[model samples]
Every structure is written in C-alpha cells, then in structure tokens.
Target: MSSSSVRGVSATPVESIIEPLRECMVSMGSGHGKETGDRRSPERTVLGRVASIMEVFNGGQQVLSLGDLSDRTGLPKSTLHRLADQLCQVGWLERDPGGYRVGMRLFELGSLAVEGHRLQETAFPYLQALAAKTGMSAQLGILDRTEVVYLERIVVGPVRLPTRRGGRQPAYCTALGKAMAAFDGEAMRAVVSSPMPRRTANTITESFALWTELDQIRKVGIALDRSEAYEELVCVAAPIRDSGRAIGAVSVTGPAGRMRWRMATEAVHSTAAAIWNASFRFGSAGARM
Candidate 1:
C-alpha cells in the first residue's frame, strides 16, 4: 500500500496482501499452464495401481490373499491393503475364507461390458432362438488371452457341463474355443506355441496334432468337442464372422450320449449364420457412430 501510494497508484488493504499470495498459490497449483491454477496430479499412478490389481484376476484366478495379491500384482502390501480396503468398501472386493476375490461390483461391471459389445447384444435373440429350436444349450465365446470366455449362454435345460456365465475354458479343448482358435491364424499359432493344459482325458494335448485338427476345422468351418473339456459332455461349434474375420463362435453343448452328430452340426451351422448376420447389422449401424 505505502509503495503504491508513493508511486501515485491506488491500493486496498485486503488486495495488497492477498493478491500476491493468491498468485503464488495459483502458480504452485498450475501444472501445464492450461488453467489459472494447476497442480501436478498423481491420478495416473493411482489408476495404474488399480488396474494392476484388477488384472490379476482376469485369467480366472478368482481369489488371493493380501500377500499373494501383492506378489502377483507387484504392488506394495501396505498400499494394496489400503486400496483393498477401499475397494472392499465399494463392493469391488470381497473377503472370504479363501481370500479376496472379485465381488458383485465386478459382476455389475462385466454385465455393462457385455452390454456394450454390439455383437453380444445383437446375437442374444438368435442364440435364444437356437436354444429353443434345438432344445439344447447355446453359447457364444470369444478368445481372451489364451482362453475362451463365455460371453453369452442360453440353456434350455439343466446340463452337467462346467460351462457357466463368465466361465473360462482352455482354448484347445472346448468346441467354441477351438472354433475361434482355428480361424484366428497367427493368434491361434501363438496359443499353440504356449503350453497347452489338459482338462480331461479326451482333450488334445499334443501341439502338432492340435495343429492338424485346426486345419481340419478351418476347412470345414466347424469344430467338435467330444468330452474334450469335460468327460461325458460333447459340443459342436461354428464360427461367427464379421467382415470376413471370425470374431467369435457359437456352440450347442450336451451330454455325449445324447448329442446326435447330425442334429448338433445343423444347430451349430444355423446359429453361426444367425450370429454372423446380426454382427453384420451391428457393424453397419456402428459405422454411423
């Protein structure tokens, strides 16, 4: 105030002291100079830590202890504990005797993901029709990191197969998995190059033999699972394509003894065609977006 008055300028008691401090605070808070006040944010690190923890359960590892989770996620135990508590409060993680696993919050998020996929939404009605027409369970699956994840399933009756909503199957054993693998070209090769884990006696464990089988599947546009994933179950699958690329598969599954080869093949072909048509429609519409 005294300096400004001497220079023949006006000054207010409040403005004289507050303006400089406010400017300093603004400069300190500014990060990129894009705003009046900015701060260097740590949001990216927080998001990365959360993503790392979430990804640890992506490949069917459902449950983990604090120590195991820390080891698997490469996050500090103290930090994980803090984050885990926050996640648990929000229903993203649930503590049980086994350990912390994905909770209903994850299920809700997965439901949203499935809904966002145009193919899943478009193919649902057709899948229902296939299930009704064949009186068998119909499933849609997509390849996800060396596994086949069941994206949608329509079951008409109770079946003993281990397949369930959000379930994962070894890509080499299940019909839906094999159908996707056979048509995926280099992706299929990558899967075969990895160690193939056997889930049943009938599963194709040899890489070379599986390779030969995939060639046959490609030629015929169909794949079969005769108790390959689970004993006493059989499945027939066909590819669902969009723009000439197989994006997923449709399958009819039942007990081996009850599944007639001719009927199952017809169901697979028809369902695959329906799904393909739906995917095409979805793609054409999505172009507008």
Candidate 2:
C-alpha cells in the first residue's frame, strides 16, 4: 500500500501513526489505561471535590476546620471556602464556631430514601406480627456500610434492648447484620475487611470464622447472635430481600434464656419470606446491594 494511503498524510509507519493518536487521546482527557491506583477520573466537575470534602468528617471527626478539610480533601483553600459556603447556605453542611459539621438537613433528606422509608412501611406489619406472636422485640434493620441501622421495631417483651429506631450496631456481632451480609457480597467483603470488635465473648472476631458463619447463614436463610452484641441478649434474624437481593433483615431479640434457636429461627425465617414476597419493589436499593 502507498505510504500516503496507509498513513493518511505522511510516510510514517502505521505503528508511529497510532502512537501519536494514543498520545492525543491521553492529552484530551481520555483514559490512560494506567495502573489502578494511578487511573483517577479526570476532575471535570465540582461534585467529586465536594464529596471528598464531606468524606473527611467521619464518626470520630464530626467537625473539621477549613484547614483540616483542605488537608484531607487536597483541595485548594479558596475552592474549599467557596464550596463550604455553598454547602452551608444549602443546609447540606453546618458551620460551627470553629469548624463545619454535617447538618441535620442532610440526614433528614437521607432518611427519605425509598429503600429505607418505603421498606420500613412495608415491613412494619410483619415486624409487629412477629413481635406479637413470639412476645419478643422484633426489628427491621438495614445495613449501612459495616453497621446495621434499625429502621422499624415492635416492642413486646419486658427486656430492654439497647437498639432503638435509628440506632446502629456492628454488623459482625448483630444477627440482623449477619443476615443481610450473608446475601450481599459487598456487605460480606466489608465485614471481612474491617476489624471485628468483640461486643461480647460470643462475637465472631476472626474473619475466617465469620466467613464460615456467613456461608451457613446463606444456606439456612437465618442467623443467630448468641449474646454477641450485648451480654445475655440473644437474637435470631433472617434476611429480607426484594427480587432475590437482600435489602434488609428482620430479627427477634430477647434474653438468652428465652431465645431458643429452633423456635426463633422458625418465626424469623417465615416472617422474612413473607416480607420479601409482599414488599419487593423495582426501585429499592436492597434489591441489588
């Protein structure tokens, strides 16, 4: 073939022509196909920078100064100030006397998620029925990262449980957490990656052991917390899924003396199945995660 025809304009080899095209692509905000750590997405929008700033404020650090946020987020102080001011104005973040913190408005908005609020309403009747049938405290909980957040509850028994609506407990030690984690691969990976704190002597601290238990829960469709989260507090739980994807868990809790495995599992498993059949929806998050 003629060089002009092969190379489009010059006598350059096809390989040489292709190399410059690749370089042009690299220079034009296209993917570089680099190593995973170096392949960061191009910063073309403010959403990423704003999210990075918000990620700096975690459980241990609820509030952070502009300087601290800048250091954590690696954003320029001028940009940080501008974004922070906008966030404050929009009620997404709050400016304290010395630092900024996540605003309650942000939480209120987050609570309105269809997966959470709508799921709570759909599961309430089942939770209430389980509580009445067993005379135990029943709860519906959703996994939030590595923790379980109680979304709905039915209180019946005399025992005082520590978890209230909107309360969080470690997923590795709670029956609800394990039940949800058993069916969701992401939740399982998160549990294995994090250090499992021993909430009680029975808490599964070793990753391998926890993995084995999760496997069993997946097969049986139920999980038991035998005095794991709190001393003498036993729980039996089963996962509630939407279209075969676990969105949350249903659990019954009581003192260890009364929370027998055969009895509690039977109740929780059936109730969870009923919830899945009746409340499964197309747009909820738990349907996939």
Candidate 3:
C-alpha cells in the first residue's frame, strides 16, 4: 500500500484507511450498503422514533410482536430489536411470551396525570348502582378533544359491549359525548369543525343535525344514542354539571330496542346528578397527608 502526502503532511497507508471510511459511509448511508434517497432527514430523530414506537401500542392494542412493531412503525427489524431492548431496560416497554407490551412503569407515569381527577373513585359507586337499577352497562366519561374517554364502566346484563375503561369513542355520535358537548360550547364547536365520520347508518354526520341533537339534550337534560356509534347498542346519558358546564357524563347502555327509554333516561339523569354531588363532596373532603 502506498502512502500519500497532502499539504506537505504525510497521510496513512491508503489501503488501511479506505476500508474504515467505506464502512462508515455504509453505516451512515443505509446500513445496507445502499444510497439513502429520502431516509435521511433531520425530523427523523431518535426521540421521534421512540415516540413512534410508543404510539404504535395505542388504540386497545395490548401486545405486539416484533414483526407487528416493524410493520406499524415502519422501522427495520434490527432497529426495532435494538430500540425495543433499550425501551425494555428503561421500563417503557416489556417483553412477554406473547410479545411486547407497554410496561407497568409507563402505566405508573400515566397514572400521575389521571390522579389529579379522582372522578373514577367518586363515580364508581354511582355507576354500579345505575347498572344494578337499569340492568344495563353504566359508564362515566369526560370529553377529551373531540372524543369521549370512559373513566369507569359497570356491566350488569349479558349483552356484550365494546366499551372499556380508558377506551375512547367519537364525541359526535355517542351519548356521553352529546351529553357533555351539550354544555361545553368550545367542545361543540370543535366537534362541528372536525370531521364527523359515520360509524353506522344512524350516525348523525350532518353538522345541523348534530347541533339540533345537542340542543335537544340541553332542553331535556339527557342525550340518546340509538345505534349511532354501534349497530346493536343504545345509550342514554346525562352530564355532570359544574358552573354551567359539563365536567363529565354518566350513561346507561344496552342492546338496541331492549332499553326502556324513559326509565333509562330517568336513571341516567339521577345518576349524573348523584355523581356530580358525590364528586364535589369527595373533592372538598380531600385532606393533606
């Protein structure tokens, strides 16, 4: 191998230096000995990649395989393995016989945010009572952006439902959403401006229709969802109000045509008010520890 001189300085042997430089180029390029056309971008940082990996586990996804992660995140298997290992070490993810899942540490961190609102504890008894009285599933939910997030649910009857604690449903088509949005003007405006996708044939997709329904809810102090969000489910809901706005909502849900509308409406209205009063007392009763 020949040495070269540049600017009167002697360089190392060319053969010895060239191989390391080629290896570095390949590592920087594509890690596959190919030109990176569009893959190189400043926005694709390590933090962004990590966030993408975390987001792929959302929407009721309990666990995912490495291949599932790769497909959902659009990341290579080797990269996923490396990042997954690091995430598992940091308690952001866990490895199981099934595959990978969001770890307990992540749940602990998320609980910090939820702890500020102790609605679940306050509303659980009322939800249980409502379910027992109505022979239907009862739920407590709050408006989050343009969706309703269920904080608690109590099931009674044999009718299977899709709802679960921490699950989300579109605010425009669900009874809980309508009950809350009826009082929150900002939430209603957000729903009006946002896209209202039809989940079933009965969903009220038109802005005017939704506005009318919300107005009706305001007048009656209850909202109804008759197979709007789901094909075979019906729900009745009322808002837990504070300062003329809804802080949360309560609902009784059951199979379509099986619910006694008047009885369900009365039950939800009382349940919502009961929950509101209990939550108020609970908050006031909090003591420093």
Which candidate gets the maximum TM-score versus the true structure? 2
2 or 3, greater by TM-score: 2
| Candidate 1 residue pairs in backbone clash | 29-38, 29-39, 30-38
Q: Rate the local accuracy (lDDT) of all candidates.
A: 0.69, 0.74, 0.74
Among all windows of 10 consecutive residues in model 2, the one with the lowest summed lDDT is 1-10
Writing each residue's lDDT as its tens digit, candidate 2 over 233-253 gives 889999886445476889999
Most accurate candidate by lDDT: 3
Q: List candidate 1 stretches off by more than 4 Å.
A: 1-116, 284-289
Order of candidate numbers by TM-score, starting with the best: 2, 3, 1
The TM-score that candidate 2 achieves is: 0.63
Model 3 lDDT on a 0 to 1 scale: 0.74
Extract clashing residue pairs from model 3.
none
Per-residue lDDT for 151 in model 1?
78
Q: Candidate 1 residues 215-262, lDDT tens each?
A: 998888889998888888889999885444466788988877778788
**Worst ten in a row by lDDT for model 1:** 1-10
